[model samples]
Target: MGPGETGLNYMQQLNQIVYPGIGKTTNDNDCFVKSRSIFFNGTTDFEQSIEEEMHRYQLIWENGYFLKTLKEISHILNGENYDWELDIDSKTKNTRSNYIKDAIITKFSKAPNFQNLLKEAYNKDLRNAITHTQYNLIQGGVVLTNIKGDNHQPFYGITFEKWEEIYSKAWFLLRYIFSGLKDIMELFMFHLRKKQSQVESPFSYQMVKNGSKHMHTILKEGTGGLFINEIALTISYISIFEI
Candidate 1:
């Protein structure tokens, strides 16, 4: 198949695997559970997807194996074998992960501020209030509560409505990162296409261009003054490419 056809096919597969209608349960409780599942599953799954795509595209771009190279470099820097799978976890406070950290350090360790900047940004306060809130997992779903202090006083609790807000933020974050990565991938592919006239690249030059353009368009359009818009933008920029 041609580049465009292959690109569309890959996009379809991506939508199926990553964009499963995870939060579409009709029941309110099921909705919350599904929402949480996306985050938890995402934390465990998205990195590998990104890495696999990156490597696939890199080979297409004639850049060799980017993920493998990064892994080797990370291993060298850390003086130990590096596992990309280890980085995938929802509870990981450090967003960049040790593997990513070692890779960055390996590449730009001598650079003036890359390490410091990365270190600072890696531990960002992506900590949503929902993550901070306490929750009890029942058979059906989870009940969210705002427990405060050592005394564990229940502050403002979350039922369906409040939980929806949190769920929306989580979903927004996930989409933001996904779209942002698409943008970066598109840009990479665009450059690669120019460098190598081959259309076999999985990077999809046009898709990344379109993705970045769309992200900018959405930001320009604005979200009608929702606080979540800020979070969406922040996560999009931060997660896909280093801010």
Candidate 2:
């Protein structure tokens, strides 16, 4: 049964015992006794509540980290440059890691320290971890402890968690990039089609040979359509294919 349902059952039992004459059926007395003992146990019910809350707190913290990273990257992408540093205070030393920064930077931008891309990837991973981890925790999954070293830690698998974070970041960043890229490509194709329509022989070698026309079309018709179109063109030409 669900936690609320279980809690209700316990309350029912407590009621029967406290007011014996009110609902003193044999079944009711039995249920009341059983549920009262189960609910009062410090380990089972109380510990479960604490675990759920902790998992939720962790999820929130991770999401916060992701949002912060995205904002930082957005600032960098806006042409403001800054040093990308991964800070880990002693309190979070065990849980926090800097490897995420390297992976994000490598995946998103040509420059080794492309701050925007790095931030975006970081945010993406954070969101993913929070989402997936919460899902696992809600399903009654046990949090395994690290008994290897001096630190007696309780957490899930490190590699799996890290990988989940990394891939999630990559997936989200790539998705964001691709969406912009697709819009630009569509705009570019539109221009090409418009130019071809205006020409005398749209399929002729001369029409195909007009490089200046293509450039002019992009500049005039494709440049100012929408932010998505502009971003798409900028990323496609500058980042991906290098036009």
Report the number of the highest-lDDT candidate. Answer: 2
For candidate 2, the TM-score is 0.27
Local accuracy of candidate 1 as per-residue lDDT tens digits, 104-140: 4445454335344334323212222223434443322
Candidate 2 overall lDDT versus native = 0.38
Residue-level lDDT tens digits of model 2 in 72-165: 3443444543223323222235444343444334334544444454554444333444545432222223233322234554444333234334
* TM-score of candidate 1 relative to the true fold: 0.29
After superposition on all C-alphas, the RMSD of every candidate to the true structure, in Å, is 17.7, 19.3
How much is 163 displaced in model 2, in angstroms? 13
Flag regions of model 1 displaced more than 4 Å: 1-17, 25-156, 197-243
- Checking candidate 2 for backbone clashes, the offending pairs are 13-32, 73-116, 125-169
